[model samples]
Target: MASKFQGFPGMDDILPGEIEKWQWVEERARAFFEAGGFKEIRTPILEPTELFVRSIGQSSDIVHKEMFSFKDRGERDMTMRPEMTASVARAVIERGLLTQAKSLRLYYVGPMFRAERPQAGRKRQFHQIGAEIINENEASDFDAIALVHGLLHYTGLKEFSLNLNDLGDEESRKKVKTALADYFEKEKNRLCKDCRWRLEKNVLRIFDCKIAECQPVIEKAPWEQFAPLGANFRKLTAKLADYGIPCKVNRRLVRGLDYYNGVVFEITASGLGAQNAVAGGGRYDNLYQDLGGAAVPCTGFSIGFERLLTAIQAQDEKAFEEIRTRRVYLAPLEDCAAVLNVVRETALRLREKGFRIEMSPGVFSLSQHLKKADKLGARYALIAGLDEVSRGKLVVKDLAKREQAEIEPEKITACFEQ
Candidate 1:
C-alpha cells in the first residue's frame, strides 16, 4: 500500500462540516465593520523579513523566535507574516493610501503564519480578523476600543472581558523601561534564563514571562509609579464608562509586541485555556517611522479567529442553529441519463434566484436522497425524477415537516412560504 499523507502537525484543516461556523463569524465581522465606515484591506501573506524585525522589534518574541523566514531565488530575504499590522503599515506607505485620505479605517481577515509550538488551540497557521485606524490621534483610541466591543457583541459573543493598559508615550516608556530594568537588574540572579536575557535585551519582555519564578519580581515592580495612566488615558477610560463598555485596567496586560505605546488592550474569554485572549491591539505611533515612513499614529486590534469561534461555540452553539436556514438539498432520483440534466438545470435556476442549494453528484433513490438531505440539515429537498419531469412538476419534500408536494418550477418560492 502507498503511504498516506496528512496535514502538517501544527496546521488544522477547516473541514467542510465545520466551515459554516467560520463563515458565520466572518460574515458578522464584515457586516459590523462595513457599517462602521471601515473598508476591507487585503495584504500579501509574505513580506520582507526585515519589516517584522523593525516593526515588531528584534527583541520581541514574534520577530526573534516565531517568524517563518526564507530567502527567495533573487537572494532577497522574505518571511510569511506572523501578524498583519506590520504588513498593513507597509501597504499604507507603499501604495500611498494615506495620501488619498487623512485617515483610513481598514479591516482585514486572513491567515498568519507563525512557528509557535503546537498546542490545543495554537497552530503554526492561524487566522485573525483585525482593523486599523491610521493617522488618528489617541482620541481615536476610544473608537477602536468601542469598535472591538461592538464587533464582539454583533458577532454573538455573550461573555468576554476587556483589559486595558497604558504603555505611555515614547518618553514615558523610556522612563518606565529604566525603572523596570533597574528593578529587574537587582533580581537578576532570581530571573529565569529567558527573563535574564529579556532584562538585557528588552526589559519590558520580563513582564511577559510565564515562568512562575519570575512572577514575584515582576509583581513588585512599581509600574504605576513610573508609567501611570496619563490624563489622556484617564479620559479614554471615562469614555468607556460613558458608552457603557466595561473594562478592567490590567497593569500587567502589556502585549508581547514592542511597537505598542500609549493605550493597549486585550479581550479575553473563558473557554480558551491559559492563553484565553481572543483579541488584542494597541497604538503603535512609531511603527510607520520605524519602517521608512513618517510617524503615523495608528491604533488597531486583531481578533484570534480560532479563539473567537471557540469561545462563541462554548458559550452558545445556538448562534449557528440557523446556518442552514432556507437551504435546499437538490436530489436527482431518476435515471442518470434522462433526469440528471433537468435536475442540474433546476439547481442552477434556484441558485440564481438566491437559494442556498446542495446538489447530489449522482442519481440516488428517494430514501437515500432524503437521508443525505437530513444529514446535511437541509430544510427542504427538491426531488427530480423521470415521473416529475413527465408530469411537468417537481416534488418538494419538506425535510423537517415531513410533507411533500408536487409544484410547478416557477412556484418554487411557494413551497418555502410559511
Candidate 2:
C-alpha cells in the first residue's frame, strides 16, 4: 500500500548506511577544528527577522527571496537562518564574547533553512560545517582560506579548484555598485527578469545570474574596471602562493551573501557537476556594527556537508571501513535459558572492548547463522550452543578466513584482537 504521508520536498531522511558517512566527516572536522584552536559554538536555528535583514542586507537573495520567515503568536517577526555568519555575529555581540578577549575563533556544524528550488546537493534544509574568526585583520582572510584548504585535503578529495576574489573595501564597493547599476540599466532589456530586479536592488548580484540570455550582458559588464584590487588584496594572494596553495583569481566571485566586503572564495570539486562548490566564504568587516554592535573585522567559511560527502564517496571506495571494523555476529543455536545467558554475557564482554556485536534472537541452525553473519558484513561469528555453554567455551569462526576454533569464553575478545 502507498504511504499516507511523505517527507517535505527538499528535506531528506539520512538512512543507516548513508549516515555512517556523515559521522565520519563530522569526526574528522571536529578533530581538525579543535586542533586549530577554534571552539565549537551552536546558535539557535531561529532569530529575529531584523537580524538577517541588517546583517545579510535586505536586498540580498537570502533576505529578499529565500528566507523562511514567519510571525510568532507574540507578533514578533522571526526567521529560520539561511546561513550561520549573521547568527554567529549576533552571539558574539550579545554575549560580550569579544569584550573579554581581543579576538574569538569559533566553529559550528548544523542545519540551515532556505526556501529555494532544490536540486542535487541543494536542499531546503541543508547542513554546513563552518568557522568564524572575529576581530582579526587581513591575515585572518588568508587563515580562513587555508583552513578550508586543509579541511578538504584532510577529506581526501584530489580533484578540485579554488577560486578567489577581492571585493575591496566599502568605498570601492560603493563605486563599483554605482557603475554596475548604470551599466546594467542600459542593457536592462536583455537581462533576465531576476537580473532586472537585482539591478535596482543589488547590481553586483547580476553576476550570479545563471540565465543563458544574461550571460553575455553579465560577462561584458566591466568588473575589473570598477572593483579594482588594492595592496592588501594583492598581499593575500602572494601569501597563498608562498604557502603553495593553488588559487585562481576570479574577478566575478562575489558570493551570494551581501555582507561579504573583501576577499571572497569558492572551492569546487570534480564530481558535483554544476552544483560543485563544496565550500565558500569571505570577510564581512562591517556586519557587527550593522547589527548594533561594536565595529569588528571577521572572516570565515562553510563547507556544504552533503556535497563534501558526495565527493568523498565518489573518490574513496573504503571511506566507511573505519566505522565497520571488528564487527561480530553472535548466533545462539539453542532456545534454552543457559545458552541465552551465555550469549548475553559474551556479547556484553565483547562490547566493553569497543567491538560492535549483533546478537541473533530465536533459534537457527549453525549454517543458517553463518548466512546471517555474512549478510551483516560481520568479520567473525561467535557461536554459542548448549554444549559450549556447559564447558564455558564458544566456537569462534572467522568469516573472512573460513576457519573456526573452540576457545574459552574469556578469550573470545582476545581472539578478535589478534
Q: After superposition, how far is residue 203 of candidate 2 from its true place, in Å?
A: 1.1
The residue-by-residue lDDT of candidate 1 on 114-150, one tens digit each, is 9989997789999999999999999899999999999
Clashing pairs in 1: none
Model 2, 1-418: lDDT tens per residue? 9999999999899996577568677878988999999999999999999999988877788888998999999999999999999999999999999989999999999999999889998899999999999999998988999999999888767778999998989998999999989998999999999888899889888888888999998888898888778888899889999999989999888999889998999999988878999999999999999888988999999999999988877777776676566688988889989988888888899988767776566789999999888887888898989998898889998888899999988888888787
- Per-candidate clash tally: 0, 0
| Candidate 1, lDDT over the whole model | 0.88
CA RMSD per model (angstroms):
2.6, 3.3
* Deviation (Å) of 284 in candidate 1: 1.2
Model 2, runs deviating above 4 Å: 326-369, 380-398, 403-418
lDDT, each prediction? 0.88, 0.89
The 10-residue segment of model 2 with minimum total lDDT is 317-326
Which residue runs does candidate 1 get wrong by more than 4 Å?
A: 1-3, 333-356, 385-395, 404-418
TM-score of each: 0.91, 0.87
